[model samples]
Target: MLGAKRETVSRIISQFKKAGIIVHENGNLVVLKMDDLKEKAQ
Candidate 1:
């Protein structure tokens, strides 16, 4: 969605996953911790 390269997107997703914000389940992407994501963004 960010129009980033496939590798770049993967790297970002990996970071978010490591941060305990997003998850992969049943072949879908789930946001489990929005507050932490927001805190990191800020």
Candidate 2:
């Protein structure tokens, strides 16, 4: 895991959402796809 705080995780999730890497639904976070994130991270 990332070993981040709740707020930190929330913030990062929000950023990822903005970048279309993941999505929040029904109070849960789901990774829509990892390709974009992986590609951009490299």
Residue-level lDDT of model 1, residues 1-42, one tens digit each, is 434466765687788778877756612533334335545756
lDDT of 2 by residue, 1-42 (tens): 334456765677778779977655623434434334445656
- lDDT of each model, Cα atoms only? 0.57, 0.56
TM-score of 1: 0.51
Candidate 2 residue pairs that clash: none
The C-alpha stretches of model 2 lying farther than 4 A from their native spots are 25-42
Q: Model 2 reaches what TM-score against the true structure? A: 0.46
- Per-prediction TM-score, please? 0.51, 0.46
Worst 10 residues of 1 by lDDT: 26-35
